[model samples]
Target: MIRTLLMIGLIGFLSLVFLHAPVRAEGEFGGLALGNGQLIFEAQCVGCHVHGGNIIRRGKTLKLKALQRNHRDSVEAIANLVRNGKMPMSAYKDSLTEQEILDVSAYVLNQAQQGWN
Candidate 1:
């Protein structure tokens, strides 16, 4: 029925909105301010991850190809790697709170998709 079709469309629209909402969460700065993610990236992740390149692991670049191949194409995958760490990458789970990890993950994904411009 038309009712069922309308409900399906509504559900699809809602799902898109929820999935794409920015994860700019409140943090040490005190409020849900934006760009803190960029700041965190600069202070913490920029050294090796600058310009989407991994200084240590050349194969694990943040560019779309490497990310996709390593099964890290999603924000959750990146966040988990950052929190848990692997090999040369030390764990930030203790250093960064969950919100900070989420923010940085969003930043990295956004930057990577833009070719790290």
Candidate 2:
């Protein structure tokens, strides 16, 4: 009975630690962390740019080819567009901090590179 209780307690502790831990990626971009980017993207950008595709404009997507075609192939460009609103898209400058903007931009670029798979 004591062994059973101890095993249950150990399993419960491990479950809490693993389930609540933040997810992290393998690398960083421009000295910025990469993990929160996904969280921020999910929280803020997922509605409009689900899976890196644009809901409002089919021509403009977060996909690699479209981004390159639109000349928004770089992190700075993406960050700028996110910071300043384009037609049909809302600017996140007021709502998100600079670091968040960069993080989300990096996330978009990374997703684009990965084909959003």
Candidate 3:
């Protein structure tokens, strides 16, 4: 009975560890662990940039063409913009960490490339 209890405890512990583990994905988008980006975007940016479309400024949309035209085609450019707000847009430097800005920038670029579909 002791052996069975020990095995069950071990199994439960292993299950918890695996279930709580961060899931990392390998892919073209720098193999980033993706959940944080989407979650952050949803929580912070979705209101202004829903589906990559800019409600505040149509010309400043997050679409690939707009991003390219505005010289924000790269992740670094996007991250900088996010960190330091440009006029109408509010800065997120205080609210989000650098890593989080990078993640969301990557996500935005990826979504733009995919046409936000």
Indicate the worst ten consecutive residues by lDDT in candidate 2.
Answer: 20-29
The prediction achieving the highest lDDT against the true structure is 3
Across residues 1-117, which tens digit of lDDT does each residue of candidate 1 receive?
Answer: 999999999999989655754445454434432365676787798899888898999998989889889999877898899899999998999999998887777777777777887
Sorted by TM-score (best first), the order is 3, 2, 1
Q: After superposition, how far is residue 69 of candidate 1 from its true place, in Å?
A: 0.6
| Backbone Cα, N, C clashes tallied per candidate | 0, 0, 0
Off by over 4 Å in 2: 1-28
Clash pairs, candidate 2, are: none
Kindly report the root-mean-square deviation of model 2 from the true structure over all alpha carbons: 6.0
Candidate 2 lDDT tens digits, 7-44: 99999998975676444555646655456788788888
Error of 1 at 59 (Å): 0.8
Tell me the tens digit of each residue's lDDT in model 3 across 1-117: 999999999999988755764445557668664566776898899999999999999999999999999999998899999999998999999999988898888889888999999
Better of 1 and 3 by TM-score: 3
